[model samples]
Target chain A: MDVETLVLVHQLYGAQSHYIDEGRATEWAHTFTPDGEFHSPSYPAPVVGTAALAKFAEDFAAQPGVTRHVLTNLHVTPADDGLTARAYLQIVRTLPDSPPELLRLTTITDHLVRHAGTWRIRRRTVRRDDTKENR
Target chain B: MDVETLVLVHQLYGAQSHYIDEGRATEWAHTFTPDGEFHSPSYPAPVVGTAALAKFAEDFAAQPGVTRHVLTNLHVTPADDGLTARAYLQIVRTLPDSPPELLRLTTITDHLVRHAGTWRIRRRTVRRDDTKENR
Candidate 1:
């Protein structure tokens, strides 16, 4: 990818993490395409569509205690004949209360597309590092 | 930040992981510059020079049981006035014995430079996900 494209993707990744960490659920949902999909080991089925995505983010934000998602090691590659890109990232969640705790370590695979001149996630799959299936 | 540079960096990352996983310690050491430096939370001080680097790789390989390093989410950017690049990546170790187990989750920050038309790591620092200091 060109420098501009790489920077834009990085920005998208950062914004997605920030919105969720800050409890901006609606904005977090906006990081996805209108018909985006999200799947996690914690969820039995994938969440699809903007409304469902919003609800998912909102529920996560409403949970007790504060959470910060630390994202790193992002690998981006072209996919779907160049129409979309695939990104693999690692996420670490920290909870600070009483004693600060490391909550989870997960890998996220994202399928992104340039929609209306902006990069948006079309699909995201979360794999927990502690899970047997993930290994 | 051009496509060529990005692709080369990606290749270097893949080769490094493959060399270690496949027990090619010397080759793994060669992925670094002659005077490369490596630091990790497990080490009290950084390991420098090709000979020391090879020893480190050999020691890691001598550990009991088979280990595979799963690297993902690589973010690369220019550094040192374009003479070097900085890459951040996440690593997960998987061991397959009685059953598959996820052993560790860590983030690696690498400084790379081009030498004789090949990209080599100048420095690498590892941070563990579960550490309080890392968060």
Candidate 2:
């Protein structure tokens, strides 16, 4: 049971990272459920739906060159609500060919559910860590 | 098992938050092992031990006003290694009295282990989210 959840959660994170890295913004947005909340507080606004998510990622991907998100410290467990499991994430990103930029390192608190026999993020909130802006 | 791990992990996060809020830096630092790594990418230097962690929190708590950390979208799962589990965290902080500020929101990737019949953070890395300074 634990094995399955761990593998699934890690795979989901990996797949999402791939989507962002590959600029598959639409597919990346598909990772979440309808009406789900996607909150990256640093953003000018939160992206909530598939369309909004896609646009957010599209704009994000339009940044500079290639990007790599290095995610670590993944904690996962089944939620009390069946079919749902919550995860806490620590993630970092790097872009080569430049000053070795740090794109976004965030704590991704995620709500995932087993939809159609696979995991999907129902809600995702990327919180800002210290060392960020005043507000 | 899932219930136990979930409770434990959440407790860890909540407890750590309490420590930081209450200025119990030493006890909070004790939550990790001797060689544990506490990495918050935005900091000028990473806090890696009980002593360093204490100072880090001390300096942080030295800031005026009350701060509340809101962590959301938690994901959890067991790790490949026995007695260890990994977690991903998306966290937010709110400092009142000044335009509803947003402090360091980050994804905290953590390595936890069962030590002496309880769980502790073996390694923690708080990645920087976008909307931070040049790094």
Instruction: Give residue A107's lDDT in candidate 2 (0 to 100).
Output: 71
- lDDT tens digits, residue span A41-89, model 2: 6777777878888887788778754454545566776676533443334
| Standalone chain B TM-score for every prediction | 0.87, 0.78
* Model 2: docking quality category: incorrect
Model 2 chain A lowest lDDT segment of ten = A91-100
Which numbered prediction scores highest in lDDT against the true structure?
1
Q: Total clashing residue pairs per candidate?
A: 7, 48
Cα deviation of A45, candidate 2, in Å = 20
DockQ of each: 0.16, 0.03
Score each candidate by Cα lDDT.
Answer: 0.70, 0.63
lDDT of 2 by residue, B1-135 (tens): 355666666677667777877788787777787666787766777778778877877876787776655544344656765334333233333556555444434455677787767688888876544433312
Candidate 1 achieves a global lDDT of 0.70
Off by over 4 Å in 1: A82-97, B1-111, B115-118, B122-135
lDDT over C-alpha atoms for residue B58 of model 1: 89
True contacts kept of each: 0.04, 0.00
